[model samples]
Target: MSTDTGNDARQQWKAWHEERTETVSAPYGPLALTGTYWIADATEGRIPAIPGHWAVDGENGERGGAVLLTATAADGLTVDGRPLSGTVRLTADKGPAAAARADHGGRKLVVIRREGLWAVRVYDPGSAGRRAFTAIDVFEYDEDWVSPGVFRPYDSRRRVSVRNADGRERGLGLDGELAFTAAGSGFTLQVGVEVDGTLWAVFADGTSGDGSYRFRFLRTPAPGVDGRVTVDFNRALLPPCAFADHFICPCPPPGNTLPIVVPAGERRVLLG
Candidate 1:
């Protein structure tokens, strides 16, 4: 590539990296997450450390369901800007944590569901993880890390049992494979398809657990009609679990681990 073109690409990469830094350090970002308490573990509506009474309705202890939260004026919980003093039913929060229906002081009580299990994720602006975070270590951008790839859709969606960062196994749904050539060798990764046709891959390379985080995530925009995409390793991301232990990011499925050293992309969280 020409010098001007490479310079422009590097500038864009710098901006993207800055934006990523801002995102992770935001009030409700991964670093701000303090706890993920399962409703099944609540005793009489009390979850350890988190204020208020939490319970699950509709499916009892199994299957998909809604969350029931009970609070009083003294609990200092607010719903939609109004102080809540009664029982309220809440479904999984679909938006940013700051927009969740429940809040206590500067903390967001985000209700989430996974594999038919209900839990409340607490995002506190004052979380120690957030306060200690300095920056995310990343390799400088390199054009050689960008490559053309193809998406091959599966005959049907498939779910594979994979272990999560939380030490539990869960089903990871995959809809396609993204194959590309990097560093003169071909590689293929199983990817999950988003509703918008974008792709997500959880992968590891020769640098994982050594020079980089144990695993990383890659997101590619929707492929073209011809199933083409730009697999940019410079933008590889540290999974949420890398910033906060409460996150249950899944491990890369079999074969997603690349044998080559991927020297570009975010590596690890730098904490003070």
Candidate 2:
């Protein structure tokens, strides 16, 4: 690509970052996610602070299992701003929590599913994280840090058990390694293959925990037939774990940590 093309990409990325910051700090973004209640815990079919009873279906060979949310005015519930008194088949949230379109008074209820597990996230504008967010501090983009790299897939895919930020153990799927070099030092990161066959990495560097956030993510587009890819450190991003403690982001595995400091890309969000 020409220098002008690279500059255009950089400018577009800057706009994306600004938009993301605004979205996260919005009234009902991730920062406003106050609670995630698993439906399994609601044995009696009632979730606290959430309207209606939730029960799992489809395990018995039913079509598209649904979380039966029985709403009633007596339960202090209102769906779409109108007093609700019937059941609503809820699937996964298709948009932001604030725009979920399912509400109980001033609260927004979000339905989610993960590996067959069902849960509901409650988002309120009064969340502590939203109130504390001051700014998103990021390292100035350095075009020199962006370079070409290669992806090497393993003979077979592998799953590694890692502790999530929520203190739960979950399996992290890995597909290959992304090899790159920066500041005269070579590095390889374990990456997961996206559905489109691209590679992604969660990594930390010497600057982590001090000059910047502990860890960030890098995503390379789908590799060419020769496995060549563009490794853009200028687009390195701080994980959601940097902003919200409730997120279950995985830590970078061994060897993925670079010895040299990556002085480009996002650092941390300035909070009060």
Candidate 3:
């Protein structure tokens, strides 16, 4: 009976991993990101590959706050299906790529603000990374890597500054910590609580940079009142940065590294 249960769980995980792979290789996925152009970097008010005069909303193109895009009919830029002409005040695009403030020629111009600096991220379906994407390499299913864990929430959320994959530092917030045991060793990971009552963890094992990618992500259902939750290393995921270089994925926080090699989950980016 135990063997049958483990086999069923392994089969379910394989299906989930396969779905994640398809999502990553989607048309507008991370691999489709072409450029991340900061407004301060463009003195001429022109972003590479984007058709428009994208100037700053304040002071000689200085990135004081928002962005002011001046798109003429010739530029063929649009907002809400209306021809964008003259100048329009556009705050950062807080929504998804399909809901970007501006777009042209079927490409999305996503505006984002980070570290008080504003930038425009262009998502082009014809990106080289997307075109060259093949598959994600994952370790074979191993039930031994799955374990039950405990979650402890804090009275308030705390933020940590961590270096991102782009070599820039950013803030990563945590709601609590998850305590679990694997490979005969106990470990704890600071986790963020998602709205859907799931926990997200970014961690690195001894296999990092050797047999697997440098870091991996895991998401599991929120712990119960008794702090009971399942920690399945077999569902480990590659951050968006693993699929494209333009993404700014946060790195692992302090004490999240495991000394033992975790030979499970998605290991590396495998191109075919």
Candidate 4:
């Protein structure tokens, strides 16, 4: 019975890994992201190499900001499946790049807001990285890496300044910590609560930057009423930044780095 259970878990992991590969290699995935242009840096409302003139529609483009875009039909820009021949106001896209409000042929122009800053991301299906990608390197599934954990919510949310892959510091909000034990060693990870109550963590292990990606993200199911959850390191994921340099994935926060060597999850990006 125990052996059967382990086999089932392995099969599930395999299926999940396969789905992840397909998602990341899709036409509009992270590998397709070629650039992230902040509106503040646009000179005279022009972003180099990007069609359309873009500007902020709000004061200094603070929170709740929108973008003012001006384009001609000749630029081949489209919004809502119609050719955009004049100016339009666009809010940050709330969905995947493929579903963004604006497009230039097969390219997606997604507007995003981070900490009151507005930026536009271009996801081109013909990106070089996507074309050269093969697969994501992952370790064999090991049930030993899974552990029951407990979530401890803080009295109030807290934010910490952490450096991102782009070498810029950003605010990382923390809602609580996840406590768990594996291999008889106890560990705790500061985590953020997702909108749906799932736990998100950015962490690095002893193997980071050596055998695996510099850092990986872990997402655990929502905690039960009793704060019970499972920490499944087998599902540890390579951050978007690992697949594309344009991603500004945040670095691991203080005390979130584990001292152990975790070799049971995604290791790196495999490209040919």
lDDT of each: 0.93, 0.81, 0.87, 0.94
Q: Rank the candidates by TM-score, best first.
A: 4, 1, 3, 2
In angstroms, how far off is 67's CA in candidate 2?
A: 2.1
TM-score, each model?
0.98, 0.84, 0.92, 0.98
The Cα error of candidate 4 at residue 186, in Å, is 0.3
**lDDT, candidate 1, 182-203, per-residue tens:** 9999999999999999999999
- The pairs that clash in candidate 1 are 45-53
Comparing 2 and 4 by lDDT, which wins?
4
Tens-digit lDDT track of model 4 for 167-267 = 99999999999999977899999999999999999999998999999999999999999999999999999999999999999999999999999988899
**For model 2, how many clashes?**
0
Can you give the lDDT of residue 247 in candidate 3?
82
Model 4 stretches astray by more than 4 angstroms: 61-64
lDDT of 4 at 197: 94
> What residue pairs are clashing in model 4?
none
Q: Which residue pairs clash in candidate 2?
A: none
Candidate 2 residues 1-272, lDDT tens each? 68998789789879978987898888887788788888887868888777587776665522346677786778776666677788877778777776675787677988887556788888888888999998888888777788889999999998888766677777778998988888987788999999888788888898899988888888888999999999988778788777777576888876678889899888897879
Q: Give the top-scoring candidate (lDDT).
A: 4
Query: Which model, 3 or 4, shows the larger lDDT?
Result: 4
RMSD of 2: 3.2
